[model samples]
Target chain A: MPDAGITAFADWIATTSLSHLIAQKLWAIPAIQSVHIMSLAIVFSSALVVDFRMLGLMSTGQPLSAIARRFLPGVWIALIFATISGLLLLIAEPVRSLPTWEFQGKMLSLLCVIILTLSFQKLIAARAPAWDAMPGVPAGAKLAALVSIVLWILIIFGGRWIAYHAG
Target chain B: MSITEFLQALESTAFATAVREGAILFPFAESLHVVALAFVIGTVVFVDLRLLGLASRNQPVTRLTNDLLPWTWGAFVLAAITGLSLFSSTPERYFTNTFFRWKFFFMFLAGVNMLVFHFVTQKNVKEWDNDPVPPTPARVAGALSILFWACVIVFGRWVGFTL
Candidate 1:
């Protein structure tokens, strides 16, 4: 459950003019959500490409660093767009968004995945050539890739469940 | 029977009713649809960008498309199946919705663009396989693909609102 302070903040946000504007405008929420979903498609797909490469599922002929360089920047850039749209959604309905366990879980999972992705990128930057020279991807890198994919899927579930599970 | 009657029947079927009224079934299907769509669009965009000479310029177009097409096809099948499941739940509602109809229109355009590229434009892929910039027809196809898919997503999102 949300604490008193969080509940108070949500209440205050609900009373704001922005919330009222969003509530009155039928197209606003869906428009914002469309942007959010499109950005998420870019981010998730980019991450999948890098992860698939790490797992030797595709593009095994290409160097890992080359593939990561091509796709990982898209993940970060699209994430910025998704976050901005998500914040607009939260502002529009703070009470519905802030107090939900599903929302909280989504944030936590997002944070973990971001950290995992960053560390993976850092490792690649430092040692991609050494690892790429090896006959196969290391066990640890493949494990991280699997974890990254799972966390991303979990985050997607949490996002959809928020509306259904919210108070 | 007429198309409308067939859709009405589909909506009233036991499986469709179960999906419509069940607490989790609809949302689960929607989430799966979204996941599958992300991969489909993502993989398609990657290839399109390559064709447009916007990204991954170092990699050969043939190699990139060949590697990514399998994931794209696999995810596209999942997306279509889940999309059908969602449509079955309220067949008439979706069938009559303007945005829903537009979504299919754009999807059809995207498919035609792909087919033209495969049959005509790509007949001589070897001519420009390794070039940083593909020929004009290939670039045009890539641009059309991006535009068509963008329309599909926007219209698809509007369907939920209009529904």
Candidate 2:
């Protein structure tokens, strides 16, 4: 049950001019990696704050909606930068990335996180005000926060492992 | 003793020796370093964004800083501890790495930037505590803080790859 289309896309990415430029330029990889890590900090930190709020950890004085409103936009922006940087890195070394189990895990984790993040955003939009008014977080919100924490840790670990175990 | 001797001696200490030799412990420390990084920088970004009048506009700057500083400091302590452990494992390498020097330089600048903001621009914080856009000096400090921290993260990562 291999996906021919996905494999073909990966092949095309490897042969692209953009990939060649990235691989050949010494500064390009480090510069892109620097931006990638910075964007990672921004997105991950923003999401961590929201998750903490959900778990009743910090910023308890502020409305969850207010905190989310303030941080989620930055999260979205940073996520975009991170994705582009990540794509460039992957394309530049498609042979290394495409065949690695850790890379596959990282991609799968990222996809799951994207889904979870969108749903969490919707949940925050609809219920954050109520949750803020309540004395304690509802069980469901806390559960979602826990799931987010686990998923994010897995994603981070997968990212690190990919480097150590790259093909 | 020479600096080299000092670093080599430090590297051979029980704690440093244990961290370097322990399979699980070194990796665990690295994970802590990353987690602590998120906590420390994330909190600083929140405060800096507020100072720049880019986010949390309705909230008073002082209150926002007060709320976030405690967490920032707590995370920083953890980061410092783990960072020191990592350094001790290979003190001479970090000492000689140019990226490491640049990382330290930016970290020092970030500290000075914070101190200047607190002692100077923050003297009349209440006057524009809720201003959608803070005064020029506060905004400058915020902007500088962001720049310094960004450099710190960049060079810090560079040290990893270069070493």
Docking class of 1: medium
Compose the digit string of candidate 1's lDDT tens values, residues A1-167: 64788879989998999888986798888888888888999999999999998898878877888888999999999999999999989989898878788888999999999999999899988888786665346898899999999999989988888878834
10 residues in a row with least lDDT, candidate 2 chain B: B23-32
Best by TM-score: 1
Q: Where is model 2 more than 4 Å wrong at Cα?
A: A1-12, B14-28
Please compute DockQ, using alpha carbons, for every candidate against the native two-chain complex.
0.76, 0.48
What is candidate 2's lDDT per residue for B1-163, written digit by digit as tens? 9999999999999999988887666666776787777668777877888888888889999888876788789889999999999899889999999999999999999999999999998999989998988999998998998899989888988887888
Clashing pairs in 2: none
Give the DockQ (C-alpha) for candidate 2. Answer: 0.48
Cα interface RMSD of each candidate: 1.0, 1.9
- What's the TM-score of every candidate structure? 0.95, 0.90
Chain B TM-scores, listed for every candidate in order, come to: 0.98, 0.97
Please give, for residues A41-129, the per-residue lDDT of candidate 2 as tens digits.
Answer: 78888887788877887778888888788778877899899899998999897766666677778778788877887887888789865
